[model samples]
Target: MVVQDRRGGGTVAVAMACGTGLAVGLLTSGCSPDGAAADDQEPAGRAAPAAAEVRDSADALVRAGSAAVRTSMETASGGTRVAIRGTGGYDFATSTGRLRVVLPDPAGRPSGGHQPITEILAPGALFMKNRGAGVPADKWVRVATASLADGNLVTGGATDPLAAAELLRGAREVTYQGEEWLDGVRVRHYRGTTDIGAAAAAASPRTAPALAAAGDGFTTGEVPFDAYLDEAGRLRKVRQWFRFANGAPKGASVTSTTELSGFGTKVAVQLPDERDIYAGKIASPTP
Candidate 1:
């Protein structure tokens, strides 16, 4: 019972707008429809905090995470394979920013089939199926824009990086919760609440309909995260869990995994290079 967040819906729009340009690892079928990248784990025994506090924390966390993400659009792998790693810079607008393919279909490899159109989302890049069944090695499509940036000029999403950041900045209260061990790291966790009324006002008079909707805020959406805060109160590693506006049930949770947090760090942005774009040197669809 996962309530797909506006992100999933936004992800689809990205696939449509890019018209199948970049991205990989977007399993159109297997992945959650609402866009919860992975399984939705239910949190336990947590008191609700004031909306203002949570929004402020989220913004602080996003800011601290600036240039901390190993930003890339990659494939799901469980074996020894080389997948195309499309790298990019974070706009922190919370909306997917500029993502370039650092590795295209490796030299003399057919990767079109496995590469589908994806929205270079924050935290990681997402590829949604548009042309082929799943991602095959033969259907890989490259960018043909005059910008020759080898990336899509993406624009869409109920919540953009800037908007999301703003809401997070206004975060008010924080309810101490539990914790989880990811990749062998034990992290502190908590859920922060938000004030939809205030959020809507922050959206401003002429905010885009979509951005406003996200900013217009919800009656109650949970901002769950593991606070790895800096000395200055900036978050270092944040695992964000977003639920429906009213704490209905399970929705989508995007975990922001990172090791550093700061502004103006040496972040990498490039187009997909063939050699580093798919299953261990670009695995061809099984014959």
Candidate 2:
């Protein structure tokens, strides 16, 4: 697996042989929700509609078929911060998507000279291009999602858009915050905490393994999130917070955000042929 140096000046190709250690390196190196109802206010003491709507957010997207997505993942440690941003489209029905992710600069800013990494997301797998370091630019590197400690959630830099919505299924406590306009669309805002274990149990089979891995990998199974849903109960935006053991006593903190739009968009994602995948060993990054 290839990861950007903490300074963002170069890339490090960590051998897959390192196994879970690679996941820790990715987290320590700073490499790393749903919507609600319509009414402006829910009557006091009334059940928050989001409690139920959030769980169905993924189903709503499946019904929509596809949508364009924008994702941002920010990690902070020892006063240094970096972010990974991505843009592309997802086919919810097929559980596949593609994104071009841009790594941060030495200053942890998105305005960097680093080339964008193209990522192809599929059930139980991830394919990346321009992975840097020893990998050929034209050859894709594939990794199994179930093998990663974080289940490719933070390891891929940008969280899978669909996985982001599915996490909401575990919402244990949710409060509808009210309605707000997001990109000219009225959406209901909700805040809650989700249980990773619960989400994995409730997730579709295609996503269950990854979510299950996340439950075991993160320092805690509880995740805090904010979600925005449109009138149709479609997820418009979500932000989630995660923490993992990054070799630090207190661990590391990551904030992941996903925004959705252009519903019903036509998205064509083609996986690379076996011949196009890189089969050679990856060299380790220099000290």
Candidate 3:
């Protein structure tokens, strides 16, 4: 999907199918209602780490580069609501990853009326299995990484796990909000806000260009962030809320959350065979 950014003066392809609007391809549902509970609870099994420590650990993970992740986003604009969910793994060393996301309709249910879309990012291209109407039933559509720069701004383009981790490293005025259980793993929650430029600057190189493009013409004020870290200091969950000061489309505000597990897990993704992939121009979804 693609949206012409009237404010940004650029045409941006919506990167993931998770949600509509600026941010896409996030797993917004399936979360426990107490996901963002208050931090007033007393010290439980493990003590929470300092804000700096949490940032450092996330930075280290980005530097090391392999983890399984589940990402989601929920957005509301002009009375339209969307929710997206995806699960995949990233390999920072090779700048590659794979993700499968259930694209949401304006009403927040799965769109496409078919299976979830699967995307694989290699060194120079992105391969996708899209089951949307009019797409071939078999074979993958390949897109050059460069064509994704504009779309990637909010989607983070390649793998969201790495970009999400890097975004946490930019948090300022960090406060340890307390402890919580995520998928049964005890984690320390921290809250803070980050400048849009700083967050874009801190993202992994693979997705930074898109971040830069997305921030154009928009007054991206402070973006609130919430991060949860496990005892080993691995990033368990990260959420960012984007609210532009200016140039925001009417009713468009995006919130993205990504959860990580299987840290250090080795994941290998191979590109599809040339005979089995389509490298031609794809017809953009009708506006």
TM-score of 2: 0.85
Candidate 2: worst-modelled 10 consecutive residues by lDDT: 13-22
Tens digits of per-residue lDDT for model 2, 2-120: 33445544432222222221232433344332234233545467454657888889899899999999998765544455567899999999999999988765455564667888999
Per-residue C-alpha lDDT of model 1 across residues 201-266, encoded as one tens digit per residue: 564332223333443232234343334433343433443323222222332222222333334454
**Candidate 2 segments whose C-alpha is farther than 4 A from its true place:** 1-48, 78-80, 285-287
- Tell me, by TM-score, which candidate is best: 2
lDDT of 2 at 175: 76
lDDT of 3 by residue, 1-287 (tens): 53222223323223333221223422222222335535453344435345566556556676557888787766543334455677898786776788887764433345454367787766545667763434575777665543443324344323356555655555677767877899999987877776546766776666565445545523355557778888777788887775433223332345778777887789888878898776454554444
Off by over 4 Å in 1: 1-54, 57-66, 70-87, 91-96, 100-113, 116-164, 169-173, 177-189, 195-197, 203-210, 215-227, 242-263, 267-287
Q: After superposition, how far is residue 136 of candidate 1 from its true place, in Å?
A: 16
lDDT of each: 0.33, 0.78, 0.58
Could you arrange the candidates by lDDT from highest to lowest? 2, 3, 1
Better of 2 and 3 by lDDT: 2
Evaluated against the true structure, the overall lDDT of model 1 is 0.33
- Residue 42 displacement in candidate 1 (angstroms): 23
lDDT of 3: 0.58
lDDT of 3 at 285: 48
